[model samples]
Target: MQIKQRHIEVFDAIMAAGSISRAATQLNLSQPAVSIALANLEKFIGFKLFQRDRGFFAPTREALLLQDEMAQGLLVLERITQRVTEIRAGSTGRVRIATNGAMAINFLPSLIAAYQHKHSDVNIDILVRSSRQIADWVSTKQIDIGLIDTPVPVAGLDAKFFNLECVCVMHRDDPISAQKSIAPPDLAGRSVVAITGQHMVDRQLDTLLSAADVTVEKHISSYYFAIARNIIASGGGVAIIDPTNGKADLNDGVVWRPFSPKIYHELALIRGSNQELGKAPAGLYNLIDRSLQSLIGIGNAGDSNE
Candidate 1:
């Protein structure tokens, strides 16, 4: 006769409980069933596994020798089950991302960290690139996903869009921070961090200043919003930047306020339309989208207060 799995469980339970009645209770079986299983197990193994002494069940020398192996086997089974659960939850995959340096700085990092906490087995990689190159990056498979501040219309890539407005990024103690929304003339003669890379946003700001007849006497030109933000934090000057990028370094004593005439930053999440996003990338995509929605709500609330 063969000793089956039920026989081993019955033996283990009896050893653990020290009696047929308690083993039955633990296994949700009747005392008679537990006794029968123990009897069958002993008969199959050709040995007496337990001994009755003064109305209590005691494990014999042979039973004691097998107990540790039984526990280890059960532990291995439990681990296998846990690994299966993690796989089903998509917690063991990899997701590679490319995005503008601004997004890499703040909200995206927070979002990625929170996701990774839940999915410790998942691997994540981030590549920082200019907004202009994000489209090509995704299309060429340089990254599984691309997050950009401006739309990129590359073939074989699809864009899911989200909107946010530019803000006046400044030191919290700056006199301009007192106002909820900064006016064009308020920045006149103030040192300003300017983007002179010929980006459309820079051109738009130039036109706005030109139309307002305002001049920023001191201008520091930079290609990266992150660099511009750092300048502002270091007491160089205030900057016009997207709220997402502007608020990325709140701990640096920088605050973002609404601009008088809003400048909308067109942001898009681009992925290869032909390729199916794997579990990790898809989950991350949904998370970033939800975060952007929340930010838009906060921006609207701020506008109401202004």
Candidate 2:
């Protein structure tokens, strides 16, 4: 025999409220209706679920066992109902996002703003970390989406190229900038300002420096972009940073020039290969594409290497 939902609801209600009268009030039914529903449920289960003495009802061991199962079933039903409601409204109850600190700080704010403009009811929780951490979070389903630096395989990730741009950064006018182009040896012995949070940028720079055999004095390892910008503006040292972070005018004394070694970063919108994009997240992802296209003066989003 098929157990109806009303049977489960009445059973759970009585177990929760511990009184037929209270269950009737919570279920918005007459006291007789709740009593009849529980009676029908007991008959279907082929056992008396409760023992009555005077006016009070006490649950039997079998009732307790059924209550445990019904509790879990009711929770699953509630979740299914909530999910259906959200889908009908064209939004998700929650969206978890992961991204590198640099992108989260500089880029994600605008993308989120654009998304909320249309789907304001959708909730967003942003996790900021290094690119490697973002990748791992996506893999583990801890985050629904990831925005990160690229050059990695997208085999197991549904990735969309967000943007690509040459690295341009600032430093106070020094002997290094006087030359039309900086040679690998020119960086030798000079103080270099690096950021701890921009992990991919640090790795790429380290690879280039290692290949060129350049040895420089490390001035500082900082997390704040403002501090890095300030250090370079105040003639503290040089910083290799993204153009997105180079918007403010520090001073005419500090000049932002393209680095001699041609290096670029690919920002990708990544999700699990098996996960399908919901309507709101897909719309937001498209908005991210539009914002990146505007920033880089590119007509389309695609891998430059391809």
Candidate 3:
């Protein structure tokens, strides 16, 4: 019979303890069991492992030669078992995440930092892609999690939705910065930095402006909220942006004011419909949920000068 784990275990114990009785005690087995295992190991290997002299069991030349290799092998096995336990506990592993531009720049990095503070062993991969691409990645299991604008363009993927009130972001030096809130008329004839594509926020802003008979110059436009905030910081003009981006740029020479009449930026946290999040990803997912809930709770509280 081939040498087995138990045989090697008993052999190592006897070599360390120097006696069958002590080896049995180390392994929590009867002396006969330890002795039997050692005998079988020696028989399988065709060599005597120990030189028994009365009570003392001295390691034979063959035993000494095998000791180092066996010890190294055992160490490898122990480490493998430990790593397995860590993986099963979600204490360590790689988490692949993808997101649209909104959360990718400022929000996700901070969230990831907080998660790594608690779970230092986890490896994280972050991908910045369009919401539709993120949805596709999540559905195909290319990513463990995805943060994207909703409604999720891809069906059959599990998605959690978050609705955030869009805020008007403007240069700190602008006169509108002093206002507690910005209404559609407040933007009339203003040089407006618009979000280029007519997405949800743009459509809503357009409807409000039209209803208010407001005509704002929209010569400057961008697709990403952070980029728009950058343009606004450079005195480019005002644009409605999500609160997450607003919060990220609190100290970036731009101010966020509540925009009326309450346009909401809908977001989705997505993952494969068929997959359950592992411990590390679940921890991050829960953290994101809590952070977004905190943002929603803040409401107009996101208004800040610095």
Candidate 4:
């Protein structure tokens, strides 16, 4: 027997309304259309659905048995439709992000705020660690995205590189601040706060100083940029770091200026090579790029070219 949704709908409507005329009105159908639908439904199921007397209809035992299943089926369809609508509206999701301490301290928070304002239903998890750790996290699928500066390629991760400018940070009243723009030669004989570890930024800066044959007093060395910045803030020595980290230095009694022979660190977004960014993360990637560009004071608000 052949059957369709119209057959069930007309059958249910007739059972509920009790008369062909009332069922037609309820279904926005003519009386003859309702009667024909009832006849077809009875034919498809090979059973009589109603007992009629004086143009009134009543459900048979078979229809009473079918009503519960029909009701459940319609309920399931309603839920599926609602859920699809919710997905289209971007109403629910979760994303995890891991990044180096530098990006976390000076950047991501503000960007996350703006992102949350727009996608209020999305849950975000932010973790701050060493760049190497963040890369591993991305590769293992422990996190959805990462931002870091690395000179070497990480296996199982895709990178989008940006030429992020580095600068020399020092105490505001220090004599190097008077140089307008510092150089490898200008740093000679100065007490310097050097960033330690195998970080690419530190390595690049070290190579540049070596090429210029510049040597410093090497006052204090640390892995975290904030520690180095703190030393510089206390009038200890000059520290070469990113401008974003030093942008807040002035308030700390220190300031930063560009280096003469601009050395750049490659800052990139790292993600699992096998994973693709979804709607929320893609929006977040743009926000991150835009925030980085803004912090460096180099690009317009719309220059977020992932």
Candidate 5:
């Protein structure tokens, strides 16, 4: 007959408790049941596991040889069961995410840290790429989630859009920083730092400046809003950047003010179409949604034409 799990369990319990009656109590089985299981295990293995003297049970040489391995195997089994339970409860898993550089550098680290604080067992992998690359990864199911600049360059992916007003950031000591809002005319003749390569923010700012009959000297151009903020902090020039990056850190000698005519930096949270996110990814996804809503609400409350 094949060795059964009951045989191994009974053997382990007797070895640990050192008596048939005690092992029976530990396993909640009758003494006769424990004796029968141990007998069956010995017969199957062709060796004596225990030597009995009066009420005492002593481990045989063969039993001693198997004891350490059996204990280790049992520990491994227990750990596997625990990990399975954690998986079922949504407390442990790996989540893969991809996003554009702006959020990757300026925003997501703190959010990820807060998430890990509660679900420490959940492993997370974050990748920074361009918006188009992030969209492609989400569409192909290569990532659990993607945060990207809109419009989403790929189709067939589920996307949630957030429209955030861009803000003007300048050195804290700059006179414009004292204003609650900055209009295009306020930027006229001022040295401006802007995103490179005719980005959406640059186009929007250009249109507004033209409409206001004002022109600002473009002093510098950068690929990322966070980099532009660094330039602004160093007293390079004022910049209109995404509110997320603008308000990321205020103690860096930079202050953000709501910009008039309300240029918006659009972003989209994306995932594969028809794909269901696992528990850990879904938790993070919901957290990001709530946080972004809170940020947008704060920005709207502060926006004014005055």
Candidate 6:
């Protein structure tokens, strides 16, 4: 038998709140309207779904039995409505993503281009922040996906392996490049520029340096590694950056060399623990992985040249 959607809503509200007055307040409907909806629903179902006693409402055994089925049906309806909204908004539905500033600048452009080519209708909104902040956003469900490096473990988030890049950074025509390889001691007592955020790159740098008993004279700190790279190029200070970002800007007179002791950065895609990744998010995440792999290949191929 066909029943109005409002009837189901009223029934669900009463079950959830366990009182007609509370359900009316929760649903933002007048108490009289709630009573009318309940009476109408009882007529439709031809059974007492709830029992009223002492000015309170309580669900009957049949209502409790039907709760799960009704909730599932409502969820399906909500999802259908969301899909329709996306279509009307000129989207197949967009996945909101946030990434570390490094990835947003160094890796996201290429990944986005490739993803758009494959799924032109799918929209993505990307925000740039530190890895730590991105991880928090994922945990809180503020965004659908996050891309960042590890060591900033966000509780209740699922992480998928993305790609790895060398942690070595470069300076343009610096005397250090002439050396076949530089030792950890070579970076000692030098001025360095670094990124700062809740998920700062400084964590890895500090770990490596502390292990080696080295200290950096932090000259400047910013969220954008690109900004730090610019400072390094202008002879302000050396910036510790990823291979992808620094390599692309080589024309600006920055030459990258491997840091001694072999530091490497790992990238991962993160989401809330209970979040169900749909077709678009999964597809876009895969596309990003491929793009990063390609970038790594190109970086590896040119390792000999540097």
Largest TM-score belongs to which candidate?
A: 3
The model with the greater TM-score, 1 or 4, is 1
- Residues 1-306, candidate 4, lDDT per residue (tens digit)? 566666766877887889999989998999999889888878777899789989888778988998888777667766777767655665446778987777676667778888888888778999987788888888888888998877534687888777767777878788767666778898888887777765666667678889989876875787767777888888788887765666552377877777767766668788889687776676787778777666556611122111
Question: Where does candidate 1 stray beyond 4 Å?
Answer: 1-84, 303-306
Compose the digit string of candidate 1's lDDT tens values, residues 147-257. Answer: 886647577888888777777888878888888778789888888887756655666777788899998854588877778888988998798876777766458878878
- The true-versus-predicted C-alpha distance at residue 229 of model 3, in Å, is 0.8
The TM-score values for the models, in the order shown, are: 0.69, 0.56, 0.93, 0.69, 0.90, 0.60
Cα-based lDDT at residue 213, candidate 1: 98
RMSD of each: 5.6, 9.4, 1.9, 6.2, 2.7, 14.0
Give candidate 4's TM-score: 0.69
How would the candidate models be sorted by lDDT, starting from the highest?
A: 5, 3, 1, 4, 6, 2
Give the Cα lDDT of each candidate. 0.79, 0.70, 0.86, 0.75, 0.87, 0.73
Model 1 TM-score, all chains together: 0.69
The TM-score-based order of candidates, best leading, equals: 3, 5, 1, 4, 6, 2
lDDT of 5 by residue, 159-236 (tens): 888888788988888988778888999998999998988989999999999999998999689999999999998999
Q: Number of the top candidate by lDDT?
A: 5
In model 5, how large is the Cα lDDT of residue 113? 93
Which residue pairs collide, candidate 2? none
Deviation from native of the Cα of residue 88 in model 2, angstroms: 5.3
Residue 6 lDDT, candidate 4, scale 0-100: 64
lDDT agreement of model 4 with the native: 0.75
> What local lDDT score does residue 287 receive in model 5, on the 0 to 100 scale?
86
- Candidate 4 regions exceeding 4 Å error are 1-86, 89-91, 290-306
In candidate 2, position 139 carries an lDDT of 76
Residue 77, model 5: lDDT of 73
